[model samples]
Target: MSFEFEKELRVTETNIPGLLVFDLPVHGDNRGWFKENWQRAKMTALGLPDFGPVQNNISFNATKGVTRGIHAEPWDKYISIAAGSIFGAWVDLRPGESFGQVFTTRLDPSRAIYVPRGVGNSFQALEDGTVYTYLVNAHWSLEQKRTYTFVNLADPELDIRWPIPLEESERSEADLHHPMLRDAKPMAPKRTLVTGCNGQLGRAIRQYAEAHGLEGFEYTDIDEFDFSDPNAYDKYDWSLYGTIINAAEYSTELCDDTDNADKAWRVNAQGPALLARVAAEHHIVLVHVSSDAAYGMNKESKTIAPVSLYGQTKAAGDIAVANAPEHYVLRFDAETLQDSEQCAKEVFRLLDEHTAYGIRDFS
Candidate 1:
C-alpha cells in the first residue's frame, strides 16, 4: 500500500494541534491478500497519541447513489474503507474560528482519513463496491453525534477536485453548473447564538450558515447556555430572531445500559422538547434537526425503524416536534454545503439531458 494525502484534503491551518495520516500497506497474491488497516503501534510510531478506539462502525453502500456520511462526533476517529472505495471529505466545524474549510481524499482500500475531534467527516462512493468503516475513541451518543444532508455540504467555489471524476446523472446536473464553481462567492457572514448548541449537526449548521449566509444564523455551544434551568429562557431576549435552530443534545450513548438509555432519552428527547416549547411560545420558527438513526438497524426498510434505545429516544423527540404546531422538524442524514461551481455543475448536468442538443440557454 502507498500513502499520500488527497491533493484537495490538505490543511492550511488548524487549532486541532495535531493530525496524522498514514498509508497501510496491502499484501496480496493470487489466492488472497492481507492488509493491516489499523495498528495502534504503527499509529504511535507515526507520532499519533495512542488513544485507542472505543467503537467501530462499518457502512456498506450499493450503487453510486448510496451516499452515507458527513458523519462525525466530538471524539477522534480512524477511518478507512475495508472493502471497496469512497471519496472521503473532512471539514473543520469547531466554532469561534476557521470553519467550513475542507480536506478531501479518495479513501480506497489503499488510503484513509484520520479525523480528530471537532472536525466533520463525509463521503460518497465512487462505485458500488464501497464499505466505509471507522473507529471512534468515543462510543455512540444519540445526543453527541449529528447528521447533515448532502445539499448542506456543497461549496461550488471551494473547487474540491476529487481524485476521481464524479459520475454525471440527472440528479446531480444542477450541482455541475453551480455559480461558485464558475465564479465563487465571498464567504458568508458568521452568526452568533448563545444557547442549546454543541452537537455535530448543530456545529455544522452554525458553521455552514455563517460560511454561506444561507439564513444569517449563528450558534453557540452548550457552554454558552444553561438550559437545565427553566429560567434560562428568561435571560435572553428572543424578539430579534427570525428562526431558532436547535442542535443541542444530552446524550449519544446507545446500548442496553439503562442509565445510558435513560440519559439518551432525557437529553435527546426532553432537552429538545424544552427548547421547542420555548421557541413556540416565543413565536420563532424552530428548526429542530433530527436523524435517520431513529429508524434503527433495519437498513432494508423503505422508511426508518426506531429500534434501538437511541432510535427510540430520537423517535420520541420526533413525535414531540410533530405535535408542536410552531416547529419545523427537519430530518437529515449525512449533509454538506458545497461551493457554487460544484453546485452549478450539478445543476447543469441535471438539465442537460432534458434540453435540445447544440442549443445553450445560459439563463
Candidate 2:
C-alpha cells in the first residue's frame, strides 16, 4: 500500500482568531509510520504561540462513535491524534464579534490544531481505541473547571454534521446537557482596564490603544471606578481584567492643614493600596505612573525629597503599588510626563518589553 503525507509542516488559519491548523510531515515505512507530534522550535517559528504547556492529557475512546467535549476552557490547548482518527469541531465562544464562529475538520497523526483559550473543542472518534492527546498551558483543577464555557454538541443552529447521529454516539451526560449557543455565556477574554481615563496619562493610554488598533481595553475614570471609594470595588468584576493601568492620583497645592492632608492621603495612598491588594489577589498586572511632580524641580539634586503634602502622598502611593507581585511603577520627569502622548508611547513600549516587576524610570 502506497501512503502519502505532507513532505513539510505548514499551518493554516481558521475563522476564529488565534486558532490554527497544522499539517505535519509523516514518515511511513513497511513497519508503519512515525511523526514529530510537536517540535516546539519549528512550530514556534511557524506562527505558533510559545504557549508554555505545563500539562499534558490523553483520552482513549473505545468505540468509533464516541464523542466528547464542546468546552471552552480558560487555557490554550494544542491537540492532535496519537492513534487512529477523529472528526474535530471547534467554536469561538469568547466574547466578541466571532463568538459563535465554528470550524470543523478531520485529524489523523499528520494533523494538529491549536485551540486558543475561549475556543470550544470537541471531537468524535472515527475508529475504536482512538487516542486524543493535548497539551495545555495551565494545570487543571476543579475550581478552574467551573470556569469552562460549554455549548451543546447537538445545537441545531451550530449545524455541526456529525458522521454518527448524536443519539447513536456515546457522550457524557454533562456534555449532552450543555446550554445552546444562544444561552451559553461567552467566555470573557483577558481585558485591559485603564483607570483615570480622563487624566493626562489615562487619556494618552486610551488614545494609544485606539491608534494602535489594540482591542479588549476598557477605560474608566473616577465616575465608574473611584479607587478612593472602597465601595467601588463591589461595582466592577475584577476577574475580567488581566492588566490595570492606574493613572488616578490626588493633585493639590502644598498644604499644612489637617483636612487637605487627609484628603490627599485618602486619594493617593489609600486608594492605590486598595487597588494593589485586589490586583495581587487576582494576579493582575498593575501599571502605575508614580508622581509626574518632577515638573520644575532642579534635576541636579540626587536627594529623594518630597517637600509638599501632595508629593508625600504620591510617594506613599508608589510604595503601596509596589506591593503587588506583578507591577510596573513608572516614573517620568516633568517634560515627558506633561507630554501625555509621548508618555503614553513610553508606557506602551515598556509594556511591550514584558519587563519584570519593578520600578521603571523613563526620566
Candidate 3:
C-alpha cells in the first residue's frame, strides 16, 4: 500500500528484512531543538507494529570504547541513542538466510533503529556518558525460564568487523563470558497474562485463582496493558497457558463518536481476533469473555443487527473468536453481579486495614 509519511520522518529499510532506520527531523531554533520520537499511527502506516511498549530500558556508558551486548531475544526492539554516540551493530541470528550477517550503523541521539526478533544486537560507545534507550514489546516475567543467547563481538567465525580494535575496547564481564548463539536454547514463558484486572470478570478470575491456590498467572489492568495497540498482545510463549481468559472490554458511550469508533474495532475486534489466531496456531485454548452486546436487536442466535457501534464491535469480536480453531466465547451481562457478598467482604477487608480510605457516596 502506498502512503505518505510525516515530513519530519524518513524510514530507511535496511538490507536486513525487518531492520529499519528512522531518521528523525530535528527542528533547531534560537533556543534548542525538538523532534517527535514515536507515533503509533505513523508507525503503523509505515508497516511497523502499533502496540504500546511493554518495557522501556536505558543504558548509560561512563567511558568511550565501553562495549555492551551482542544479545538476542525472542521479541522485537526499538533502540535509540539518547545522548552522545555509539557504533551500534545488529546481527541476524535466525537459522537460514543471513544467519550471521551483521548490519552496522553510526547512531547519534537523533536516530533510532528497529530490530526485529532473532537478531543479536550490540553497541560500543564512542563518547563518555553516552545513553541508550530501548522500547521492547514483550511482557517480562522472570519466574519462567528464559535463556538469553549471546555472541562474542570478536568471533572470528561470524567475522563481525568492529569499527575499533578489540584491544582498545572495554567489555563487561558477562559479555566476556557469554555463550555462542548457535549453542543457545530459547526461553519458555513463565505465566498466562490475565489483563483488565479492574473489571468484574478479571477480578473474579484473580480471586478464584488465589482462593484455589492456582499459580503461574500474571494479572494486569488497563493501566498496565492497553488492548487497542496492535502490538500490545504479541511475543508471549503460547505454551505457557492451556487457556487464555480475555475479560477486557471497552463499553463506554464514547464509542458513538466517529473518531472513537475505530478504537472500538481495534480493541474489541481486531485485537481479540489476532489473539485467537495466535492461540490456534500453538494449539492453546482461548476462552474469550464476550458481551450480550453481540446479540443486539437480532431475531435469533444466527442473525445480528447492531443498534450501536459498541454492539457492532462486540459482534465482530465474537466472529473473530468463532473463526479460531480452538476457542470458546462466553456471552455475559456485565451490569449484574452474582457475588455481592464476596465483593462486600473484600471491600470491608480493605476498609478495616487502611487508615485513610475512600468511601464513595453511591446514589
Candidate 4:
C-alpha cells in the first residue's frame, strides 16, 4: 500500500533533478545485517508521489561482468540490490532543464535509487549471481517501452564509464547496431528546409540547433516556402533532408479572422498535409510541431475537440502528420513551451530510433 523510506533511507540528489538515491541503514549483529527496504507512511509524508508499486521485478546475473540495462519505464522505480553490486546508469528524458543528462551510481544491498518518468536507464552487474529487485509504479509494455539492453558505454557523446574496460563489457545484438548519440540525431541532414526561419521561434531554433551541433539544416524563410503553391514540393530536392521539422505555422489569432480562415486552412492544414506527403514520398520522417491548443482547454482528452478555430486547424495538421507513413507530431503548450535548446535535444532523441523512439508498443 505504501513505502516508508524516510527514517531509514538517506536521500541524495544528483545533478539531474528528480533522480534520487536512498541509502538504507543496516544494523548488523553476530548473525548478519538487517534493513527495512520499504516503508509506506514515511515516504508519503515527504510530499513525494506515493509510489504505489504495481510491479516487482528481480534480475539475477549468474557471473561477474554480467550486464543488463539502459532500460527505462513509463513510471518511476525503486531499485534495490539483493546480492553483489551493480553500476546503474540513467538518463533523464523529460523535456525540461535536465533533459538528456545521465547519472550513474553503484547500487548494492544497502542502497536503492528512484528513477523518474521519461528517463533512459540501464545498469551492469559487477559480480556473478548478482541479484537486484525493482519496485515500480507502472506495468511493463513491450511495444511502448524505451529500455536498451546493450548501450555503447564507450560512446563519446554519452561518456559513461563502467567498472571494466569497454572491450571487456558484454553486449547484446541490439547494442551493437545502436547509433552513437552524436550520430543519432535526425537533423544531421545534408539539406534541411526549416520553415518560418525569420520568426521568433524559428530564429531561436536556428540559434540553438547551430550551437548544439545540428548541422546540414538549410534554414528556409517565408520568402522561400509557399506551401499553398501546388508546385511547392517540386521546388526543392527533398532527399537530403531525411528528417523534416515543419516549424512553420499560421498563428491561431490569424486563423480566427474570417478573411484569414482560408489562409489558415491552406497554410496550417493543407500545408502540413503536403509536407507529410512529400516526406513520405522521399522516405523521410516528418516532424510537425503542432500546438497543444488543439486539445482545447482540456489537456487530458483522448481525442481532439477544440472550441477555437486555431485549435481546429492545428488538429487538422496533427491528423495529417499522424496519418503519414513516418512522422511525429509534437504538441507544445505556449505558456510552458520549452526553450529552443530543449526542442533541439528532443528532436535529436526523436530521431534516434534506438533511444526514446526505440521504446515501441508491440502490444
Candidate 5:
C-alpha cells in the first residue's frame, strides 16, 4: 500500500517567514513506484503552517562516514533518505532541558527523520545507494546549523570535540562561516512527572530512571497515593508535571478464584478511569500500561490464550483509558517468581513431570 507523508513547520528564521508545509507524493507499481521529491509551489498553495523553507537541496553519499553528528544548533530540519540505509542520531544540545536527550533510529528507504529545532543530529550512510534530503525551516543565506569542530571537547566553557574528522563537503564548508558557532548559548531545563510509582511497573520505571541518571521527576507511587480513594486527587500538586506513566492496575490472577465480580470491576476498570479523568483535567500526558490478556481466549486456550475473568476486566480497562483523550495505553505480558524458579522453570517442570508420568508423550 502507498502512503502520503507531509509536515507543517511552525517557526521563523532570519531568511524565511510564516508557516511552511512540505509534502511528497508516493506512487507504487509492480516494481515499486516514484514520488515528487520536493515541490515549492504545491507546498505554498497548501498553506504551509508557520516556518517555510526558501531553498531545497539533496545529497548523495557513497560510503559510511566516520565521526558523524551528535550535534545541534538553533535550527530544525525534516530529513528523508530516498535510497540506501543509514544510522541516524540526534543529541539534545538544547542544554539544561529535562528531556535534553539523545535518540537514534535507522533511516532506510522506508523511514524518515524529523529532527526538531535546536537538536543536534547526524547520520552515517550504511551502503552505496544513500541519498539524503533535508528541508530547513530557514533559508540558506550564510549557511546555518554549523558547529565548532572541537567545541564540545575543547573549550573549557563547552569542552566539545570530535574523536574523528567530520564528512566534509561544499555544503558543510559554507556552514562553517555561520555566526552561531562563535557564541553558543545554553538552553533551559525541562521537568517531567511520573504517576503510579508504588506498583511493580512503577518501581521498574523508577529503577530505569535512576539507572539512566534522569532527574527532576516527581514520582507518585501507590504508597503515597491511592487511586481507589476518591479524595486522592486533592493531596498532590498537579501543575509541576507534564508526563504520567500509569502503571496502576488490579492483578489478573484473582480471576482464577471465585470472588465477587464487583470488586474486580472497581479495581480493574473504575480505578484507571478515575486516574485518567484526573490526568485529562490537569492536561498531563498519561501513559497507561495494560496487559495482553485483554485479547481473551485464543485457539490455544490451555496455553498461550487467556480464558479468565481477569482478561475480560482488563480489556474493559483498556477501553476505558482509550476513551480518555490525554491517555496512552500500553499492554504487555510479564512473568515473575517468588524463589529461584521462575514461571518458565515451573512450566518446564510440569511438562517434564507430565511426560514422566505418561500424561504426555515426548515423541
Candidate 6:
C-alpha cells in the first residue's frame, strides 16, 4: 500500500503545556516505507526538551479497536507508532490551571506525541497489529508504578469521541475501574525539598508552605538530611524533587580561627557544592541563599570579597552553587529584614514569578 511520502519534520503545540505533536517524514518506495522514528538532535532543536531517555517501551494491539490508558505516569514519554494507527487522547492531570484539559488526535506512522510526566495518555487502536512505542527518561520500577495517576477512559467529563466505541474495544479491568475526572486527584507536581528546617528561614518557609496548603514539599533539618554527609544524598530519591532550597548553613560568629571553621566550611561551602552537583545531574533546580556579607561592606558590590569567615565560606558556597545547570543564588540583607516570615513570603513570590536563572538579588 502507498502512503503519503516525505513531509517536512515539524511539531505542533497542543493545548497542554509541554505536550507536543510531531509530524515525521516517511519515505515510501516500491518495496516499503522507512522513517526515522526519533531523531534527537533535530527534535531538541525544534523546542523539544533534551530529556535523557533511559528506557524504551512498546505496546502491541493484535486487533482493531483495542484500547488502553488514561494513565499519568511519573516520567516523561515520547510516543509514536511503529506500525498501524491509533486514535490518541491526552488529558492534563498535573496540578494548576490546565488540569482536566483534554486534547485528542489521530496518530499514524507519520506522527508522534510528547507526553509530559503528569499528563494522562490513552489511545485506541484504529488498525490491527498496532505497535505503540515510547521512550521514557526513567526506568520503570514497581515503586514508580505506584505513583501513577489514573482516570476512567470513558469519563463523561472528558467526553472523548473514540474512533471506535470503547464499549466494543479491548481494555484492561484495571483501566475500566479508574475514577471519573472529578473524582480523580490531579497528579502532584514534583516535590520541593527544603533543607535546614530548624533554622529561622527554613521554619518560616515551612510555615508559609503549610499555611498556604502547598503540597509536595518536604522540610528537613541536619538531623534528617545531613548535607555534610554524602550518604544522606543517596538515601532519598532525587527524582522526587523539582527544586531544592538550601537554607542549611553555619552562620556562627564564634568560628573565627577555631576547629569550628572546618564545620563551617563543610556545612556552608562543601555541602552546597555537593547538593548543586546532584541537582545538576537530576536536572532539578537548586535554590541557595547567599549572604550580603559575601559582597563585603559595599552593599552595591556584585563581586564576592568576603571580610569575615562567615562571608568567606558563603562566598565559596555561592561559587559552588553557581555550577548547577539551573540555580538561584538569592542574596538579601538578613539584618534589614523585619522578620523571617516576610523573607519567606518574598522567597516564594520570587520563585513563582520568575523563571530567570542565576543570582537573584532580593534586596
TM, every model: 0.41, 0.62, 0.54, 0.47, 0.41, 0.91
Q: Which ranking of candidates, highest TM-score first?
A: 6, 2, 3, 4, 1, 5
Clashing pairs in 2: none
Global lDDT of each candidate: 0.53, 0.81, 0.67, 0.67, 0.51, 0.84
At residue 52, candidate 2 shows an lDDT of 63
Global Cα lDDT for candidate 6 = 0.84
Q: What is the C-alpha lDDT profile of model 3 across 1-363, one tens digit per residue? A: 111223457688877777888876656556755667666788767766443466888899988899977887755688887677888888777654667777888887567888876677899988889888889766555622254567878776666667777778999788886666565433322245666667765787787668766556677765676555656656456544545667676665668787888778877887788777766664445566666667776536646566778888988888887766556665654453244335424433432343111111110
Per-residue error (Å), model 6, residue 313: 1.7
Off-target runs (Cα >4 Å) in candidate 4 are 1-8, 146-151, 183-363
Error of 4 at 212 (Å): 24
lDDT of 4 by residue, 35-92 (tens): 7776667654543445557689998888777665454445567788877888888766
Instruction: Quantify how close model 5 is to the true structure by its C-alpha RMSD in Å.
Output: 16.2
TM-score of model number 4: 0.47
Query: In terms of lDDT, which candidate is stronger, 1 or 5?
Result: 1
Tell me the number of clashing residue pairs for each predicted model: 55, 0, 0, 18, 21, 0
lDDT of 1 by residue, 104-203 (tens): 6676776666776556565777776678888876556553433211222355444555544444311244334433222323222222242444655455
Off by over 4 Å in 5: 1-192, 258-263, 298-307, 334-363
Q: lDDT tens string, model 6, 1-363?
A: 124569899999989988999999999887888999999999988978777787999999999999999899988899999888999999999877889999999888899999988999999998889999999977787867778999999999999999888889999989999999999988876778999889888999999999999888898888887897887888877776678988887874644767689888888898998998898887678888767878887768587888888888888999999888778887777573337787787779867875321222322
Candidate 6 residues lying further than 4 Å off, grouped into runs, are 1-3, 252-254, 297-299, 354-363
Q: What lDDT score is found at residue 152 in candidate 4?
A: 46
- Tell how far residue 351 is off in model 2, in angstroms: 11
- Which of the predicted structures, 4 or 5, would earn the higher lDDT when compared with the native? 4
Give the candidate number with the greatest lDDT: 6
- Cα lDDT for residue 289, candidate 3: 65
